[model samples]
Structure formats: structure tokens, C-alpha cells
Target: MTTKANFPVTAGSIVVPYGHVIGNEKWRGSEIAQRLQGKIRLIFEDGLGLVDFHLSNRTCILYISEADLVAGDEFKRRLVRFRNARSLGGIVIVERTQISDQYFLAVQKLVVLELGMVLLPVANQGEASQLITQLVREQSKDHNSNPFLRKQCSQLAEPSLFRTVQQIPGVGKTKALLLLQQFGSIHRLCNASVKELELVVGQTVAQQIYSFLCS
Candidate 1:
């Protein structure tokens, strides 16, 4: 039997149930649903595996556990779906510590920077709601006037330096900004050394960044 349900309209918002629902007694399952009341047009979907919440702006927040993230080919395939989805501003992955190093590395190279998904490390699923809410708020604001949103919307249309630079191996949104400040351009940053990157970011992250550049 199909688990999918017709998108339900409540208080003028569309609530669609999309995935397999495994509920515990604690209401942890409906955390997004509760936190997002009256915020957007779409409802919190229970079935979406790649992203826990998809906003009206098409930005999605994915809350990943160790098991779901390390499913090898399956994981990569889901990421591909996120990449191909239309109207995507960006994707956010809320990470847990149980994720294996290999899976984390794959996500870093193939999913995050390449696909324009953001990586947010959270202590657990409980912390994802606030972050998701924050992203929704930011995205729902003025697109034309807000310089940040304007830039992000342009990024949604096509890859921009604001977004593309983050795809570099170990670089994230923050690190990407730092690299831009240090190197003044993506071209120069591409040739940056482990030592130079270390001075900007840190030793461990620099090593990872340099290794990814080399590969």
C-alpha cells in the first residue's frame, strides 16, 4: 500500500505526508511539524528521506542519521535527486556523529559543494528545528531588495561565486568566505597550498581542503 497522502490544507497551508513514518512515544517524529506552524505554504513531510523540510523557496533541510547517510550507492542517488530538483536555493544536511568517515567524505566532495547543499553539524535531531526555522525565515524574506537573498536567488538560477566557491572539497559557507578574503578570487584559491590554507582555516581543515584540491 502507498504511504503517500494527498497534501492536506490546514489554515491555508498545504501539508503533504511523503515518507515512511516510524514514530516513537516522545513526539520526536513531529518536531518539524510543530515548530513550523504558520510559517510557510508547505507542511512538514514525514516521508522525504533526502530532506526533512522543504520550504516554499525550495530550500530543503536534511536531517541525517549515521545509518541513512552511510547507505553507499543509495546515499549518492538521493543526493542526485536533490541536485536535479528545481527551484532549489540550497540544501542543508544536519549531521550526527555516528556517520562514518567514508560517508562523510563522500558527502563532502560529491553532495555538499558539488550539489550546493549546506552541511550543519548538530548534536542530534532535536537541534535541527531551530536551524530549519532560521533558514526558512531567511529565505522567505525580500528577494529583490535584500542583497543576500538577491544573490542567493541568482544562485538558484545558476551557480554564483557566492555558492560555487563553497563546493571546494572541505570548504563550507564560512570557510568559503574566508578563502575569498584571503585569496581575493576563486582562481587564486584553487592554487592555494596546505600551509597557506592552514593559516586561514586551520591545520586539519587545511589538509582536507588541500587534499581535495589535489584530487
Candidate 2:
């Protein structure tokens, strides 16, 4: 029920050194902490409040045990409170054994769809530790080295734009070229009135294009 403001540590001000994870004092000597010892530096801290682990300044993890799932709606409320607080990007690490499997779909819908937070299910604390190690390593990597970022930066929009325009009924390379020259982009072309499109591709084709796009 409490907001992130109640936490003693400020997420914005907390700096997790590269390859290090700040863990809630409650996890001290626990399975996760013990498993993580050699893979990544684990620092125990007090007053993390609802957060179980801090992966970075902007990202944190919340662990949900099978017991928590069986106990009731308290875990859901905690997730909602953290989401409403918007203190950091929350990655929920939930224990998904046979018993907790029944609750998985509902929790997935609530965490990923309703609240828009990341949900990662693990068999137990040991698996959670492995996942945490990978996450920490990924965080330590340079932004440019990320495959997604590299792909986004390398992509050229022109090819896709031409392909999309050509998909319209009766539109070929020539008409597509004329449309691109006049409108410059698919967004502008889609919004063009029949009268406006007629200046480039004649009245009949213009109407067809308009109908195809609008319908």
C-alpha cells in the first residue's frame, strides 16, 4: 500500500557500479545472493523497501515466491503500488512451480498487459540468480553493442516505404515513384484527398488509391 517515496533510498540517486547488483538486506546469505556471489558483485543494503534487488539506477527487480502467489492478492498490490510510484523499471522475478503455474497467466496479464512491467518467471531462486547475472552483464555492455540498437541504427526506411506503397491495388513502381515524389512519405500519401492525389496519378487511379488506403 505504500508508495516508493516511503523507501529510504532514492532510485534516481542510487548508482549501481558496473557488474554489481544491490540486494535487499533480507536476501543476505540467501540462495539467490549465494548463487550470485561469483558471477556478479552483490552488495547488501537496508531500506530498499518493496524492491528486492537493484540491477541499475533505472531498473529494479521484485521477487515473488510461490508462497506469495498462494497467499493472495498482496503481491499484485505490491506490483501495482510500485508501478504507480514509477520509481524505476520493474522486472518481476516470480517463482513458477507446479503450484504457482495456475496463477501464471493472470499474473502475466496483470504485470505485462495491465501494468506494463516486465515479468520473468523462474523455477526458483537459483534460476533467478542466473537470470540476474545475465541482466547485469547486459546492463554493463555498451549501448552500441546491443543488437537491437545496431539494427535500428542501420535500417533505411526508404526500401520499406516503397514496398508498402506498392502493396496498394493497381500501384506499381512508376505510380509508387510518382506518389513518393509528390507526398514524400506514406503518412502524407494516406492522408491525401482524391483531388490532391489526382494531380499525380489521374482521377480514377486517385480514387482507387484513396479507397484502398482509407478502407
Candidate 3:
């Protein structure tokens, strides 16, 4: 349970999960249409579509009619708490839609099962579930498995670093992201001396960063 699970479990697969949305009245139609359009585009783009969503002003509104929401680093910023995200339109579409709490968890859980995290129940419901389970099990086995699958395996099919950066001193969300963008790797950035770090973060911050990392 502690090890992070991923999403999509596997390409071209899924189950009948529950879903709904809540949002502003003025923008509902536009938002719903946008969601549907995005689903269509994404399915064709990467064979993936909306899983679930909540209409709390806690997230940003993505418009497909005029504004582009795909690419340019698409992600659900988990660290930041968002609010006041009312959908702006004449129809009151989902200020938020297509992604719900359960769907997210389900996708991640399914990914974990795929990554050999745990053995779960047969979610197939009829012959489909049994067939899917068999296929997944046969595709991956604990012992004597293919080396490529283990070495190149990924959660939700997205690339991920095996180590956690949360415990790094002075490396909160913002700083961690800054380092990731600047240095492109944690080990390399951490290996920097105070003087070298100063070139990038200035004298005061460089010292603080070095001390925090070396600590």
C-alpha cells in the first residue's frame, strides 16, 4: 500500500467505475462539451480518456473550445491546494469534470497490480474479467520473469525516479521542482559544492542549499 501505484493499469483496458460532476451553472455545458471533446481527442492522441473528476473550485478550468489543455506539461499538481475554480461560460459546464476521486485511486491501484505491487480481486465481472486476469498474470510473473519488463517497468506507463525526494533538507516542493528543472537530476545537483551552487542560486541561497544537502 505504501509503494505508489500508477494509472491506466495497461493500455486499452478498464472497468465500469462510478462517476459524476458538480460546477457553475453558466459554464456547465461548455465544460461538459469540452470534457467530451478532450476525451475524444485524448483517446485518439494516446488512447486514453477522462477517468473521473470533482467540480470543486480547487482546480483550474481547461477549455477546449479556445484554450489548449493538452501538452505543455499536463499534470494534476498534487502538492498545491487549489480553490475558487469556477467555470466561466454561458452553459455552466463542469468547472471540473471527467476525473473523480475513486477513478484516480482505481487507476493507481490497477497500475500497482500491474507493477507487481499486490494481487487484487478479479475485477473482470463475467468472462471478460477472468480473461483479462489471465492475460495480465501470464504477462507478468514474480520469479523467472522477463528482465526487460522488470528493468523497464513503469507506473501508469509514465517515467518515474525510483527514489523519493521528500526528505531532502530545504528541498520542499518549489525548490525540488526548481532543482529538477535546472540540474535535470538530483544526484548531480546534490554533489555540487557551495561555491558551484552559488553560481545558480547566489551566495546566500547557495550556502543554505549546500548545508541542507550535505546535512
Candidate 4:
């Protein structure tokens, strides 16, 4: 019942082994833990404090039962404590049965909008187990496997480059085209000296371009 904001455990301090989930001892005999057995290795630990499950060093899960939702604002206060503790990236898994459905929106707003934590609704403990399996697998995979985390190969369009170059004072379509032709790219053009720019445009225009770019 002690929802202390100053819980000693922190996300950075906990080291979860690869491909394994460190679950709080409270979930040892629960349905979610039973279902997660074959899918991913689950290890139980005592005194996890505010966290229900540690998916990784940086991420953890806080589960809210139907009973918790029906009880009152205790879950909200617990979430607030967890958020204030700044322990980990808390992913809240809440029961969303017809009985608890009414409280979902309010819980979502507090968990996602106010506390800035991830909120996922499960119909029951069985569904919660499946979601936890997927999360554990995602955490175990190499970061490069994720498209968003992968290195992107970006190529700037010539039309966009031409338009950007023309934004410089005294630079029109003709001078922009000429500068691009001489320098090949905006990076090279920006590095070009006023003397170098004189070759593309006149001395006065070159000074203006140099000043516009440098300024």
C-alpha cells in the first residue's frame, strides 16, 4: 500500500538480461505469468517497488487489474508516484473488460497525456500475456531490425536545392543554376569564397551572395 515516489529502484540501475523479463514476485502464480512462460523467459524478483515487469533496462510495465480500476483513484495515485519517481519508461497495462471500460478514457488521459507513459488496454490477463510476449520480443531484437531505428539514405531533390539557393539575396534562377553547376551542391557553394563566387556572378553580386550565406 506504500506508493512511495522515492522508491530506490530506477530504470538505469536495473540490468535485465537479454530475452528475459524480470517480473515482480506478486505475479508469480498469475495467469499472465503462466502464459508468458514458453513465449519468453520470465524471472521473478522481490521489491521491484513501482514496476510490475522489467522488459529492458530502460522500459518496464505497470499492470492495473479490474479490481484496481473499480476500487477508485488509487491506481492513478500509484501511477503518479511511479511517474514522479522517474524510474523507467512505464508501459501501463490495464484491464478493459465491460465492467472496467468506463474508466479507460480517464486512465488513458492520465497515463498518456499527463504522465507521458505508454498505455495499453487488455481484455483480460490472457491478452495481457500475449502483449507482454510481443513487447519482450521487440526489446530482444537488434535495434537495427527496426525500420525507424535504421540508418536512412537521404538524397536532396535538385528542385528543392535550386529554390533554397535562390533565397539568397541577388541570386535569381540564372545565378542559382550557375552556382549549382559550378559547386554541384549547396554545401560546396556555401563554402565558396567571395572571390570564388565572383566566377559564378559579378563582384558585387558575389559579395551579396557571400554576405547572405554567411549572415
Candidate-wise lDDT, in order: 0.52, 0.74, 0.31, 0.73
lDDT of 4 at 120: 74
lDDT of 1 by residue, 1-215 (tens): 11223453222233333322222112333655454344433333344444545444334445555666665467677667766754454454535575454466566656444564556655555466565556555544455644333222332222234455675667788887777667754446657888999999999989987877567
What TM-score do all the candidates reach, one by one?
0.55, 0.64, 0.24, 0.63
> What ranges in model 2 sit over 4 Å off?
1-8, 11-13, 150-215
Predict model 4's lDDT versus the native. 0.73
Ranking by lDDT: 2, 4, 1, 3
| Candidate 1's TM-score | 0.55
Instruction: Pick out the ten consecutive residues of candidate 4 with the lowest summed lDDT.
Output: 148-157
Point out the higher-scoring one by lDDT: 1 or 4: 4
Total backbone clashes of model 2?
0
lDDT of 4 by residue, 115-152 (tens): 65557778999999998887776665665564323122
Q: What's the count of clashing pairs in each model shown? A: 3, 0, 16, 0
Q: By the TM-score metric, which is better: model 2 or model 4? A: 2
Error of 4 at 14 (Å): 1.4
**Candidate with the greatest TM-score versus the true structure:** 2
Candidate with better TM-score, 3 vs 4: 4
Which is the leading candidate under lDDT? Answer: 2
Tens digits of lDDT, candidate 3, 87-169? 21111011112323223333232222222121122221232223222332333344444322232233211112222232344
